[model samples]
Target: MKYSLVASLILQGSLVLGTRDLQPVHFKAPSALHFRDIVRNDTYDFGCRPIAHPTEDGQFTLHALLTESQIAHLTEEYEDTDLSIHRPSEKRAAAATAPIGSGDRFSGGTIAPIGLGTKASGSTISSILNVKEISSAVQGLVSTYGVTTLNLPYKTFNGATQFAAYVGAGTDKSQYHLYLSAGVHARERGGPDNLIYWISDLLAASKAGSGLTYGKKTYTNAQVKSVLAAGIVFFPLVNPDGVTYDQSSGSLWRKNRNTKSGSSGDSIGVDINRNFDFLWNFKKYFDPSEAPASTSPSSETFYGTAAASEPETKNHVSIYDSFPKIRWFMDIHSAAGDILYSWGDDDDQTTSTTMNFLNSAYDGKRGPVGDSAYKEYIPSVDLTNIKTAATAAVNAMKAVGGRSYITQQAVGLYPTSGASDDYSFSRFWAKSGVNKVYGYTMEFGYSTNFYPTLTEFNQNILDTNAGFMDWALAAISVGLT
Candidate 1:
């Protein structure tokens, strides 16, 4: 069968959020762990201030400008931390302290453009395509190639719908699945764009009757055909309402548009990243100083009333469970230059191929635990083939644009419970069998500003394309193994 008609036959199942208890969980935002301490906090670095409390709108408006000293402090903290895997060369680092000004495209300046499509990459492409443009592009691919495009069965509080594009090489039902999803937090605009660009490149190559190339290696027709035999699913924008609000209103919305009543503010959303069921709101998953879920509904990282309560979270879980064979799952996020693996809730002392290779590449021999609560645990599967694929993905990314993304377990970045990446991996890996899915959160861009200006955003997209491509290719290879 031709590829274009393939996905249309796949079921666009109803949005079935299975029956679950809806008891409201009082998530009190820890007073000690203010907004300043959150790993994903970009308020100071970007032109924004933290609200004293959550508002009717779940996000803070991007209006507060930071002082020179505050900007410097945040920049220093970001640079000095281990989470920052690669730094700009010495020449760029020297200019890090300059007074914030309208930044030039090439110079490592602080000021970034506020809008998208202000700059063009080629005659056909520009920086930062909006949600509409992105969705349209995906549809175009599906129309031309007969690939599957699944509309998420649920709409946001504002009635915004989302979709996922599936690209596969064959019609085999039991083919291994490789999942790539982005835009979980609405403010992180770059995640979906990266996947879109990667998909476009892959589809273009497939159509031209040519093979895809990575670094010095080129996959011939037979290789491409064989590798693509597996299924690749890309959920580009999971939080459409949040992205729309952030782009259109310049608000820093970070959660799905869920208009439920909360404990403190009238804010009506839940942080989708923290709404997953795995380790959901388990106080032990976070440090006393860093309670992962906020008690206040208005706070940024608020996990919802119940695990998987939000429709978006339910959609993600439904997709994962529905897939027959998943060898790799990547929940792409932004503004951090890290490739994080599972066990985000505790210190990772597991002995598996994935852990060994990830720690070796990014952490040397000894994998550093993210917190003191973690004790050594064993993995259910031997991760040799999976580790090989991961090493290739990381190396390929670095080879492209000379931009290196640090690889570590998710907890290495910060202690957070109910994150999607951890949940995705744990579902398979935590099982006592060898049928494991290598799950990850591939964070793009090194800056705190999830929403960068058109020029910078485009540049980051271009620079990271190599890595994304390599990761996709590796995903195909691992599926075959």
Candidate 2:
């Protein structure tokens, strides 16, 4: 899909031309732009948008078509600010001031403090895992577990390359009953981290003397061994193209890279989250022209030319279809401290008992009480008692730290469409006759203009990993028993 060229006049003396490509378009400013005015007014309307190319130079050059006044405003607003745009007071407020101690035998260095070590090695597997490499790696895991790999086909945005992969269970296919995936949102820093950490933890726990227990629950090595005895199917980086674009071109990129024909040549990406098949067109019904569109290739909320148009989306769907036993699913992302549930559009809808069960297993059975600052900034939805796997994970993280965080649907922050969790839940309910599919969207932490320092980055990963381990093992215990 490709878009026609278009132009629009801006508030001040600025002309905006829309073009499609991986590289962002550059606009020259006549004078210095002010930052204070821009931030106050939300100039540039900077959220997430699509770009033409995936390169550092390509990203740095792309400019939002803000007017001279807006540019001037932003220049001044961000000139002296650090990458995070976080004020010193805000940083201090968000910081964990109280000391974190390991209880009893768990005290001292044995308890790894946040960001305790150098960032974990091999965080950039996306750079290494191409279609061929990913396929080979999955095959190796499948072979080791003595299971059959379900071959699935997918198509890319360019339509030039096709993606194929195999899915299967562990050594004893009957025992290994879960389907696993991560990196659904290419732009999120934690998506890849979650995948890497998950695999590492699973492998370590599989070893004879790893001593990794499933959270607070006491599971014998034999039981832990039984859980691993039946293996999992993983698709770590489903959207490689988007991931590459995010890392190299723009941090705010959110959508498949497919181009489409449209009025504003500028808008040219589909919100893959809104591209799923369930309640899929809600965005179109509400905003119609703005997003969730049946037409308009350049729309950020484009629901694909039709459902499953993008290869990446289809590949994931195929994974679900092939693996009937995938009782649990999780799609990881970052920045938002949220764990959203199904029926994201409304708060009154009822979720399955299994989903509710897992939600409790994951989110400590209670809603969070926001911190002073967060209470002031966060809305009520963040405090809602929603049974969602994502919220469960957030509650677990909070339990360990004694901090309060939000848990609700993604729509509480912003409305999204075709999200993987939504799709997974719908499918699980339809197929299993039981909502055994406990799906979640884990938002790690903020990592936009400012990437976390090495310490902050490491801490975020470890905290999330520990939280997920506790949640996963507990859920498994409930399911098996």
Candidate 3:
């Protein structure tokens, strides 16, 4: 007896495949940590804010942005006691005094589109609208399916809620479970658009192909509906406050608006990504002043006052905790074509097996090891030779003309704390006692800033959604079923 496997490409509310069978395949996780040094250097540079010329007393007034602990650590390591440090306030004032139009200044940009496309007049492919409009459009496709909302409350913003919509078999005995989310970072244009279009297409396709497509490789309309019927929840925007702030105030807003720290001005929010509980405060380099003002409120890269301090972070944690059956979760981002995996905060010293799994999944072909002399200076996780499954997914995506790279946390491009993928993995291990929960952070598209040409933007969304769903479905087929 041959069992047929059907995969549905759900975007634009349409079914686009026939049925096929699951082939015997071997998958291994990645072991090597590449791009670690580059990330480490970036983090270091973020801490190093060069000083202006000499101060009033003819002494060079250097501003050390590092925390007290970081300063202490550096001092002990390098024995540089002569260095003077400035407080967060002084730094803020200095930054403010600098001209906004100055090339050296870091001006917070905007993510809002300069023009709005009317529903009927706008191109079907690219148009960034409010959440309400996106939601209304999706309702047309999955109206019959039960819709359950997860109201994630926000404290910083009055009565703000992070929205999630569930469609499929109602939380009971669903064969294939999938969780879809976008806009974890508000500035990413692809997040919201991809989510809305994917849902719409999935529904429309399922309706049109009810019985036309079938089997393992190809999905029939019925199979597509069954997958949806099995249960798929869509969280369109995870960081509502951050996204709203990005649109209205600053395009560079990466954290939530929650003021956990007691400081006023510049340092007014926590990098919600760095506010998770696992390996909680493990900074690659020691930086005490890096700590948020009140341990609650922060300006940038703030790791909340404590674990789960921000409501947005809590909302994610709660969702993962409440749903044990959620086998797959993807936290979407943009600007980089990356599909990052678990243990992001720090190295998972205990879980070498997980690292190996990731390595193999990524098909570990070591890059040029750029500037080998500088390689040893990089920080990286020590693991076996196996490649990461996340990397494999990225490679597969890349093989098809998708640009991607596997990077270590704190050592690749950016070092972050309290990420959703890390949090979800921890929660999964705790709840299920099994570390099979495959979570990823997908950075979609490189050419497009917040607003790319509609055609290019739409295609990028389609390709990414396709690649993601394909890998996800394939991974699920191989691992889960």
Q: In terms of TM-score, which candidate is stronger, 1 or 2?
A: 1
- lDDT per residue as tens, model 3, 37-145: 2223322212211112223454433222333455555446534333433333343223321011112111121111111111122334434545444444444433443
Model 3: weakest 10-residue lDDT segment is 19-28
Best by lDDT: 1
Sorted by TM-score, highest first, which candidate order results? 1, 3, 2
lDDT of 2 at 56: 32
Q: Show model 3 residue runs off by greater than 4 Å.
A: 1-124, 137-146, 153-156, 171-176, 210-230, 262-265, 283-299, 346-415, 428-436, 447-455
The Cα RMSD of model 2 versus the native structure comes to 13.7
Give the TM-scores of the predictions, in the order they appear.
Answer: 0.68, 0.59, 0.59
Q: List ranges where model 1 is wrong by over 4 Å.
A: 1-124, 171-173, 211-227, 262-266, 284-289, 351-373, 376-387, 429-435, 476-481
Cα lDDT for residue 232, candidate 3: 71
* Model 2 stretches astray by more than 4 angstroms: 1-151, 158-177, 213-231, 261-266, 283-299, 350-392, 399-405, 428-436, 447-451
Distance from true position, residue 448, model 2, in Å? 4.6
Q: Report every candidate's CA lDDT.
A: 0.55, 0.44, 0.45
In candidate 2, where is summed lDDT lowest over 10 consecutive residues? 367-376
